[model samples]
Target: MCDRMPLLGMFPSQKRSPPLTIMNLTKLHPFLLLGSFCLASLATCDTAKANDVVGPLVGAVESTSANFLYRVGESEQPLRLSVLLDGDVVQAVDSIGRQEDDFVAKFSISNLRPDTRYHYQITNTKTGETLIEADEQHAFRTANPARHGNRVSVGFVSCVDIEPNGIWKEMQGLDLDTVCLMGDTPYIDSTDLKKVRTRHREFLQMPDLAELAANTPVVGTWDDHDFGLNNGNGHNLMEGKVDTRRGFVNYRAHSQFGNGKEGVYHRVDLGMIEVFFLDPRYFSQTEPSPVDPTQPTCFGAEQWEWLLTGLRESKAPFKVLAFGAIWEDKKNFETDDMFTYWYERDALLDVVKNENIGGVVLLGGDIHVARHLIHPQRVGYDLHDFVISPGHKRTITELDVFHPSLEWSLVEGWQFLTLTADGTQAEPTLTAEFRQPDGVVNRQVKLPLASLTAVDSSKPDSGLRAHWSFDGDLKNQSVLGDRVDAVAVNDALVVTDGGVSGGALKLDRSREQFARVPRSFLDDNSNHHTVSLWFKPTSLPAHGTSERHFLLESTAEGTESAKSAWHLSLGMRSSEDASKVNLQLFTHTLQPATEIGAAPAAKAQGGFDALVDREALLGRWNHVVLAFDSSSLTLTLNDKQIAKHPLPVPGPASEFGGLIIGGHRVGAGRNFDGWIDEVSIWQGEMPAETK
Candidate 1:
């Protein structure tokens, strides 16, 4: 048996009256007709019945707000809605039926606290009588921001169809503060306003769905199907498209359908994160071209300007931009996807880069798959894109192809994503989890927060030279003229725990694991220089061990007896006290032997050793600096000068052959074990103390 009330005026009465044709009723105002129908129904039935009122589904949930829309499925007399928050009457609104919509009643509530959970119930009253009431209390939570020193989790999904068993149950299990419906929320491909409204009513009436909707706030945007047709765009002229847009506006609270305008683009701030919901379907141009400047567009000029301005002005730690179609140009059959609109997409990216907007993550759906992408070669920092789809519909099987920036991809699955932000530290952290339909987390990735925050790279005297943070890749992040490629030896060196963020490289002691760069980049040995790095040793060579473990060495290729221009190593301070380990800095200047009277004097070496305290170099990450001035060489540990030695012979040191990390350039000995990060070489003097 259908749970829906018949819309064709099939009220039970003692005597049958002539049927009122809907066409004839068009002459009367919709509200008048609605009122007349209600009065006639009431005259034929008992007004004391409690089953006449249908629903009070919750929608348009914001970080600190909520709105409820309900309808009197059969009631004729005016009804009053009483909303209770935590057992206290917070609001009571009498139904102004047909004034807003023919049969719907809307109650908007706001000014609530963020991250707070509230339980609520709605009751329908008429003439001092309670006719309908909520079966049970429902709960909802406000969006939590990371700036409040709290962690926030948000779940997102797309492409769901009205079904007996929808994924709403699974979504509720995620315990998310807010749920984003990325589009295709309902499979209502119709042009009739009545049909669209009916589909929405049927879908929301599902038992589990009703419970979830009433308790959890839902924010959504629409795609083609929900907009009245498949591949619907700005050119859609179907009779129902306008009504579909109207229904969306009436249903969702956070949506920004411009005052008397048509687009559903809006922004919501969830504490430390700001989410921008875009209208990719309504105002989109027909068949946008990437190469032509005069062609159509995805987000028209107005929306594009609005989006860029919002992003620029937002102070949130994380910014999420969401839309209905895939952001990348997969070159599939869908011409409306972001790829075909590359010009607009690239323009947005340019603004993000040029304006120094950080924490901007792109979210999208409609592909019926889940994937993560990294566009590493973008204008500024790399852009991370995440896609989750098939919120409840059947998945489609497709082959996944390899792309340079494709981190992970999968097909034929019903899944959603949870993005959690941790803002407890100076640099906030965000973690994204891809979960299965059963609420099991399938894959997770933690992004370095510093990358999400834009930095002014144009500053001079930032003291950044050859910096290698070793964050996922080996490319130099500095602009000091030299860009060197680092190669991992034996593939044994992998990124491991222990840098400031993503982690550092772990050089296994058992294997001949090390990394190396070219000598040409660091050939400026003639100037005052400073080299600093963070390293943690698993174990220091016991006191008298003859082997010298080199953490970094810039030297000319030669046998064991050869000298290096500069090196930081752990070795015995002479064979006498071989049982004690010392962090040593070696700087040498070689001069050809000159013999006026004799044949040729042996090559003379001039240098000094600045030894660091051995105890500070083991177990924990220690910041060591080897700085050189014209007259002296200094070794600092954790910003405090520990050792200083006057240069025995220092005019201008000669250039070394190559730079080797974790070991010597030419030998397997002097291998370093453990973690190393933030290796930098400066061509000027370094201060004894740094923040």
Candidate 2:
């Protein structure tokens, strides 16, 4: 072999060419020759012709066996190749079939030892010539098997484009056993294969990157950019089988990963760690109209089954699931990006919680930034979502907003992690390192595994409360007319005509106006609590055109109180046509909506044909205070509880959004129009009428 080669220390004639190019090559590498022409016998092939048919190398990937893969032709073909494992000659058949096309070939080398180093070269079996004279020698390493007494370390990275100065070099010192490639590997423009190939070359040519892959095995899964379009999901493809096969062909041929099926998803064991890689794009469903949160799904039936079976049967100490995109929150719940298959996530969470499955950590990429999310028992099971994403080599994008349970969500430079294990105990250290292309670490943060799990649930859960100043001044407090204030009268705030005035506060004159308070303000630093607000309306509207007055309001709408969970409002009329006035207090869980308060059959008095008479409030101010404890919502009129309603079972906060005060424009619905005063807010129900 040494006498026949040039790139390696084989042949004397194939000496070093300082500025080597395809045109100057004396012979085509055996791998390129086999790729260019389907010649059964490599001995008679023309090395010159092979050199002329050169293209960009793309989808450069390594398999579980640590065999490196690359695409150099229209088809992902099986190329005749020779490899040096730990500096030893290991001639093998590095061929994987080209799926869905003739021009593309899927090449892969399997059955290799773990934690081993290997150097490889591609050449034509016939003529001893190199295809790209300069790219003759490249190296890679296989992943170490997850064995007993082994402390396997791994780093995860995702979302990268072709950039000159990348952080790949600094990420190398992370001391990893496996590198999780979480998609968006290359910017496959879908329209241009050249760009795709160029992107692949950008990563391969990086000396730092080459060293990393040569030292650590890479496991991968693809997202939109690497697959084709920007947000392309399932069903997106290039024209004809030729181009369509090119995308996945390059990915499959170049990466060491292999799936039982065609899509890029698989599993591997790293001592105590077993990772389940998921490809959510393939099984995505056509987004439904009106968007339903209860039914969002990413994994199709078959994939879900496969994932479940694998999880149920795995014997590893920890199940580390690598998701290519965000799972806890869908892209756009209200529009096209909404998920239609939520059953799978729910089922998975159920299994993890109920089955007592410990050490289950979900890792995701695709948001462009890194964040750690912990979903505690707000209403369901508590779990940890440990995510770390280095979208670009130089991270500069903000991915998420402020979250109360967030451990660390930052947009700095790239990140790398080292996870060591001792039996059932695994310690993961994540380093948010800001580094340069030359391997200089600027700023770094080393987070221990305890930071990932030791969260305190002692803080009071976040709720609404009510009180009265009773200043006896009615100015600038009214919901209508700017400067309509109302002051405290004895123990209750007095409301007359303008109610409370001044301070640029205005009320809805066209309808009955009331005041509003935010539920978040009422949250008593705890997950659950009670709230109450006091209101006084001078007069209820007799005409249906006048909007109903609101003591409290929320975004959720519908006749069902369950739909509008945790809302406390007092309104007259159901819609534009309803004549009866209904006073109500409601809470919503995942259950249904329920309402408390009597509905009038006819308008109230004062020219009212149905429901209660407006005459009841025509000439006097009525004191109404609503209070909520852990179990019930009590409405008090004149210091006496008139309506006591049971609270709904605790559940997801549905129909909750921005807070609205005074009268709300209920589009073809009922609007609130009445005066409100003596609004005292607290985190919990007003001190239970002090014994």
Candidate 3:
């Protein structure tokens, strides 16, 4: 057993021999053709002498069980597998024939000793000829059942087209417990079943990788490129979705494919470390909102719940959340990773934070760069995303953009990460090392499990609950670091200079622009609160028009005015006297079960609202405040108290949604065309000045 954790026994970079000359090195970063890997493997196997077999490829090896896969030509002798323990036969499983399905056979064996090394040989049961003709004997070891005894590690590889790809050889010697082919492992951008399956096999069966996979377990989920298209999503993204998924499943063996239903998201437990491999492409839906908030899904609903429930129930000391897409906010709702699926992303982090799931480290690929991104105060701890991409050299297109949370990045490509988990120590830690093919370490991070589980981001704090001084980034700045940062929907929000402070978020009415707030800040018990902000509206409709401009809203699209949980806007009063900018506060006091309800008469309405108007409140920077003290709600404009009304409800209201700023979520006509700066919120009461 490997007892040394990365942190406890830090090994400095080793001396390397002279660099192997790579072909076609260029100034714009070199490209390694896909032929390199296949050609290298073919040369080693000698095509004419490879027998009738493609593999004795091994997979899904656990503490007591193992699975094997292979594709062979016309051969009658059914293969038999022998598990050799020190030259003595310990256990064996005979291959089942299914020649019609492309000469494929599978072998499954159980009751193997844990943490013990054993050699394996596939032989013709009738002919008595050993099928494995490799130069070296093939072998594998089982996982340790002792959950916290030895250190466990997995190396991540993706976008695997680098030539002179010595990284495979580097990993060949590590004897890692598992290997995660993060995504784009085979680069199949077509839905053709044959191409998809063949590419996967070639990558997995590459000579340098073949021996390693036979010894160490290989697990994977797919990204866009390997998922059969670039930026593909939804249920019908692929022509034959079933076959595309089967191509992955048939070529590589995972403990379970998805939840035994749809998708490929699965959990792999390695000693004290458990990795949740997410299938971002399979179940993703296109949610174009101010949405039907509940309609948009990335993990779909099933996988979303499965992930949350699993995280909530997981007992592993180190839990790794693996995504085929990067965690950075790219704002390209149609194609980018987590940012487009902000709801699920935030929801997952919220669960990890609220439930105190410690030792949660995030992993990502599909962006051809090696990076360590630090998200400050994420779930009570500074969350870090370790990203590795381009198994060799450069990629077709490197996903580039400096996220606000970037700690460091090295784009020399040729990158992979060694994710090691050590739970034997008092403070178990998950260490991630982003390294290159040349044995150079770009960055390494070792975070303690205790640090991750300690903070309570949702455990209510006094005073300022939220503050957003755009200030070049969108992170929530408050005394309490709840990790509830704002999300810019549809690339609609951007921070610009010359605000009330350093910078302010700019939104245009011509585009779909708004910042989505987390649900926690607008919970049911948040009636007693103060909200203040500075804004300058650059665009507005004529006074007599029926168009209402929403500045802050929680209403779902295609819902009735009375159905919205809350809507704060600037609208007309009556055409005859609609001469000024009227600030309207609308909210529903709902039945406990529902957020939407039937219209109620003015006085019969349950929650408090007001129509406070000011003639000179447009085209210039102005300060506005909305203060509610449970009993009453007050509206103030430019340091002047405009209106104070008793708390009542117009209709049913449920805290079932999130807040959006600088526009109504549904359309551009109702969006606030403005610059909003220094938005702040206090949970307990109104600010002293307002009172």
In the order shown, the candidates' Cα RMSDs to the true structure are 18.6, 12.7, 12.1
User: Which tens-of-lDDT digit does each residue in 585-679 have in candidate 1?
Assistant: 66554231122111111122333444444565667888878776645667777878877877555433443544667775453666777788888
- Put down candidate 3 lDDT per residue, 231-332, tens digits, no spaces: 776554735656677677767666677867567888877767888999887777633222226435667667777788888887777788997788754433
Worst 10 residues of 1 by lDDT: 593-602
For each candidate, give its TM-score against the true structure.
0.58, 0.54, 0.64
The residue ranges of model 1 lying beyond 4 angstroms of the native Cα positions read 1-55, 74-86, 94-102, 113-115, 129-136, 144-146, 164-166, 238-240, 286-293, 377-379, 399-402, 425-427, 459-691
In terms of lDDT, the best-performing candidate is 3
lDDT agreement of model 1 with the native = 0.61
Ranking by TM-score: 3, 1, 2
The lDDT of each candidate is 0.61, 0.44, 0.63
Cα deviation of 32 in candidate 2 (Å)? 22
Off by over 4 Å in 3: 1-53, 74-77, 133-137, 162-164, 259-262, 286-294, 331-336, 395-398, 457-691
